[model samples]
Target: MTFRSFIARTRVLLGATALVLAGLPTAASADVVFQSVANPTDVTKFTSPWCSSCSNQYRIFDQFTLGSASSVTGFSVALYSLAPYWGSGLNFSIWTANGNVPGTELFSQSLGNADFTTTTLTGTALMATTDKVSGLNLDAGTYYVSFYNTNLAVWGYTGGGGNLLQQGNTYHTGTSADFILTNNVPEPASIALVGLALVGLGVARRRKA
Candidate 1:
């Protein structure tokens, strides 16, 4: 029946809401774990003729470093071709860095042409592909991602590309490529609830004044 009593009841309701939120499970969201900045001036070209001697052993590798442990779930790359047709598929791998070179293979998979969602950057000239990976657990260290195109279609990379993450290089060995890695990040519901409770308290204080 009283104005102060009403505010007190509202505060109680807000506190109950916060308690309920705290009991709920935290939600997981995806975010970029590593990123490469595109540079026009440093595009590395991968052509069959130039790498005729390159067998199954040769794959383009771009370097990255993690400051802390991570759980990687997916990756994507920008690709293009000067020729009329895009490549068939790409073999992707993550490797441990041996000094400045790719050392041990950690994970690898093949993504077919159909897996790539075709998007045009400049009238079918540039495109990108996205694929989910089984969450790969990695410790804080240097690493490399390698790409092997099944066909002559170029894997876009700039030797001069900027390291947006500030932990790695843009390209390696001219034919090596660059890509973005993604990981699941846990977001606590309790944090949001606490924020809401603080806002409600601020409003109540203003009203009382």
Candidate 2:
């Protein structure tokens, strides 16, 4: 191939490489923490802040049900707090629901003072954290998630006020904390394989030309 043609093909290969790299999954993410054996029934992802009428030691309560068997590795949440609330530590936990409210405690975990980090969200300031990993496995039923032990964060909503259903599915409970759970370690997305195919196609087209 002439030098100009060779350069053009090289650029195509590099561009395709960039796209694939961008789409590849991270080594780990609290976002895609685990794979589910069965879909979570009445699934909803929750996040809360003390938007109004919240007090010290406020408790968050949310519930979800699994269709089959699953093991939850950890949880993560969007935490909102002001300067006054920053402190030495924060606590979180999972529990069973009684009449769709916080009930018997099942598992609990704690965070160091510095673990919480902040970012701007929707023109609001908030602190969010990575998956606080745990060793809780749940069955084909319902359970509640709660975030407590902080004087600094907002309550987002009270008693199921701001929980959102996963786009098309109904939420399992009326109210809960903002958190995501993982059943196993995170996995790569199928898009990476698609990227490889695209790269192959681009190389083939260049050769034919």
Candidate 3:
């Protein structure tokens, strides 16, 4: 085939490929949006009731920021329970930031066996539980999150983490503990696919010449 005809066919092929790629949605992936490490000085407390009639119930809150719009897929938290209670129930709440504190409540729900998976450290009672959430969309801004076990032991947290201004008790602290928030992020490789297509076209054109 003549070089001109070969180039024309290549352009058409590239155009079709570009259109297909553009129409495809970005694949979602797990991303850690925020992670608070364990602090030694912070007070730890039992944030939830062990039973339905239990009067000793508590809650805890932590702060995090998002640089861009994101959808939360799930979260993982550290627990200091006597034994591993995988697939146990837990509660979560999200709120707008109010000057270093939680303001208006945005989302709250109870997660059950269907929503969670658990892992326990070897030779230790330390357990970490991850729960799947029905995507919570939020704009770029600061926010606060609070959570507790529905019927389990204490939540590992840093009561105020040496920040005296933070209010509340160990059962209901103004600060948070060791935890991580996961977001559904678009894959960066999607952009590279376009570049790869262009490179392939260039390679073919050189061969024809």
Candidate 4:
């Protein structure tokens, strides 16, 4: 092919790849994306290893906004246990953010009562998908997901000894870092749009050729 023809073909291929990727579901697209999340260092960086004697609640902060109003169905918790959830019997309280800093609690639920299970190969942490938590409508604004009520360890980053959460009449710090979690579903409509985008890409390529 001539140099000009080769350049055109390369552009088409790159455009096609970009279109395909744009359709894929990503954390920012359809998942519970965290804000100011701590980086994972090691398995031993588990925060809140034990809340048995603790009478306070600790919650991390996340600021998420949507292009349009949508309902958040559920989330997944990052834990650091060597055994199954039932083996250690872990539970947590789910909350929806309201104000700023430590935000006001809008919704509440027992994480144990909801569906929970390990998602990865090691089976260290648990993930409860949709149908676990009820629906909560979200719009173009900031929000936070907070949890407490168990002694389970969480894969967190850089909040262990610094006050990251507050409960009762006191502000508490992390044992190591902040808890890592996200509870949201990629809406079926969004998934369908992605598929359509990919298909359209094929048509566009054929037309370009």
| Top candidate, metric TM-score | 1
RMSD of each: 9.9, 11.1, 8.5, 9.8
lDDT string for model 3 (142-173, tens) is 88776655344434444433111122443234
- Best first by TM-score, ranked: 1, 3, 2, 4
Score candidate 2 by lDDT: 0.52
The TM-score values for the models, in the order shown, are 0.55, 0.52, 0.54, 0.45
Q: Which pairs clash (backbone N, Cα, C closer than 3 Å) in model 3?
A: none
Which 10-residue window of candidate 3 scores lowest in summed lDDT? 46-55
Q: How many residue pairs clash in each candidate?
A: 1, 13, 0, 11
Writing each residue's lDDT as its tens digit, candidate 4 over 59-169 gives: 433333445555655555555555422333334333344553545666665655336655542445443332455655556555555545445444543443223343442
Question: What do the candidate models score in CA lDDT, each in turn?
Answer: 0.59, 0.52, 0.58, 0.47
lDDT, residue 28, candidate 2: 52
Q: How many steric clashes does model 2 contain?
A: 13
Q: How far in Å is the alpha carbon of 53 misplaced in model 1?
A: 9.2
Stretches of candidate 2 off by over 4 Å are: 1-26, 29-48, 51-57, 122-124, 155-176, 183-209
